[model samples]
Target: MQLPAKGTPPPARDASGLATLLRTAGATDTVLAATGGWLLSERRSSPATQDGYIRDVSWWLWWIQARGMDLTDVSFIEADTYAAAMRHAGLAPGTRRRRLSACSSWYAYLQRADAAVRNPFHRMDLPKRASKPSRYLTEAQLDDLVMHAVAHQSARTAAIVAVLKATACRISELTGVQLAALGHAGDHWILTLTAKGGRPHRVVIDDDVTGPLLDAYLAERGSAPGPLFATRTGARLQRSYVQELLQRLASSAGIPDPHTLTPHAIRHSVATALLRAGEPLDVVQALLGHADPRTTQAYLHVDQLERSPAHRAGRRLAAVVARRLHSRTGTREPRPADIAQAT
Candidate 1:
């Protein structure tokens, strides 16, 4: 098939049209054509996801054409070489990984359909990303944020912040929450969130602050079965709108770098608070609804622990050990003053 120009846009969202376009462009492999169609037609995939997959796959096709190879001719070595080329071309590590993942998904689909003999990406190793410290607000900063939202912004904004910090839920989860999903257990309220992969998990709003704030927001929203957080027009709040609201609140609160104060940052603050309070990793994993414990472990921060009781205890123990050694040896560890005096 004749490949499109190097910078051409990806195929449109119509699955059948996309398949026809691939076939007309000289993609003679039946499996390759079918995989492209399947990707476009997958019910779980959003339009944005479809566009991303198409772009990534289009880049792969262009690469194969440039190298005088066919889609079905890609071997493990070719796949590895493509990754190496991406790296040498100065693509970011995350971008390279995403592109490789898109290719791997296509191959996996082909394998499921018995269109390919083997998956070339089966043995491909992804680059390890350096873990950065999770950005979060101090407890005082968080309190200031909430106070600003409550006083300056609307009740909806305050409730949004409260729910995010209390539940440590993703923004998507918060926006998707339905009023019907919220339930009261005696004195406290519980939120049933459909997290990533449509997995439903329940979290309790046991704190007095969150529960009262949520109650005020709900009272303003009225007894409705729609989204827990909706606009004046009764439409569910969009993710971007929520992000902008948080930024505005952060600015009003006098927080530095207001742009960095996001829903995820609030979630990070909650996770760090829990971990520093001696919450078990497994408990945090369950609360965050992480399928893997390692994912939850990433939210744990050592720096946040500096002000905790356990950290103070550790410092006290070290001091005690030093004093014991001094008494036993009849020689204290020399201070900078003692060294200077001796010199």
Candidate 2:
């Protein structure tokens, strides 16, 4: 069967658009039943996740049709080729994996709906997610970045940076924080946000530094009943805006490889910094909101330095060795050279 010719783009947000995409790609009866009939009506996912599945499946369908191929007759070799193309396009591993999973899920659902069709993506070797943060700012670099934000005039932007540093919250959490979600909780101010799995998560606003920065930002933002982080016109802050803001901040901060700095990287930086400060691995896990302890352990692989907890532990070992040498050591710790680096 020939693929349907591309026409004027259909209205996408509608659920029927997904069925249209499958029909246009020449999907067989069973496939259509699984996606358009069962999944749309039965699947329990957030609206965003549901839309993402449709959107991702649309790309695969388009690619298949572009090759003048039959979707139901796709062979394993063709699946590998598509996976390779995704890599060659420079999509991140997580992105590639998610897209493949999205399409693969449709095939899985087809079987659950008592229909069988070949899952081209099921056997293909998808991209491997990075075991640890591939890139992140050092604590020193974080200070420099925040300093640049302070010098700039955007109070909202500065508070966003400060909160990310202090709480290690995800960008979505940062953007989702409402004025109503923020409240005082004893020594620390608390922010309530929905976590990754639609769970209630509270981020602590502490350390004096971040709290004060947010205070100034909130003063300027006024007691508005909206998102704590918003644009100049008072609309909710979008992720794209935060990304572009960082690009500008990184340039101003003189940070190397400005594009590498992201809100998630700030999360990684704080996790690493906390681990470096002798914070327990499990505590850091809780701070970052990783439900799995092993996920947080990945930060332990970060290269140890003079500032590492292990290095600090070694100071006592060094003192023992010094006593063996009959040499006196300094009685007190030296004053820290920099106290401005708060996160």
Which candidate comes out best when scored by lDDT? 1
Model 2, residue 86: distance off in Å is 3.5
- Assess every candidate by TM-score: 0.69, 0.71
Clashing pairs in 2: none
Taken over the whole model, the C-alpha lDDT of each candidate is 0.75, 0.74
Error of 1 at 125 (Å): 4.1
Clashes of each: 2, 0
lDDT of each residue in 1-343, candidate 1, tens digit only? 2334334565533455546545644665767556756565643244445656776766676666577765665699888888888777667787778878878888777777766666778758987674666568877888888888888878888888888877889887888788899997787678998866556788999567888998888888899679889888778888788888888888878998998777888888888778878899999888898889988887765555565899788566666666665766666764544433433
> Hey, what RMSD does candidate 1 come out at?
7.2
Residue-level error in angstroms, candidate 2, position 100:
1.5
Q: Model 2: C-alpha RMSD to truth?
A: 8.4
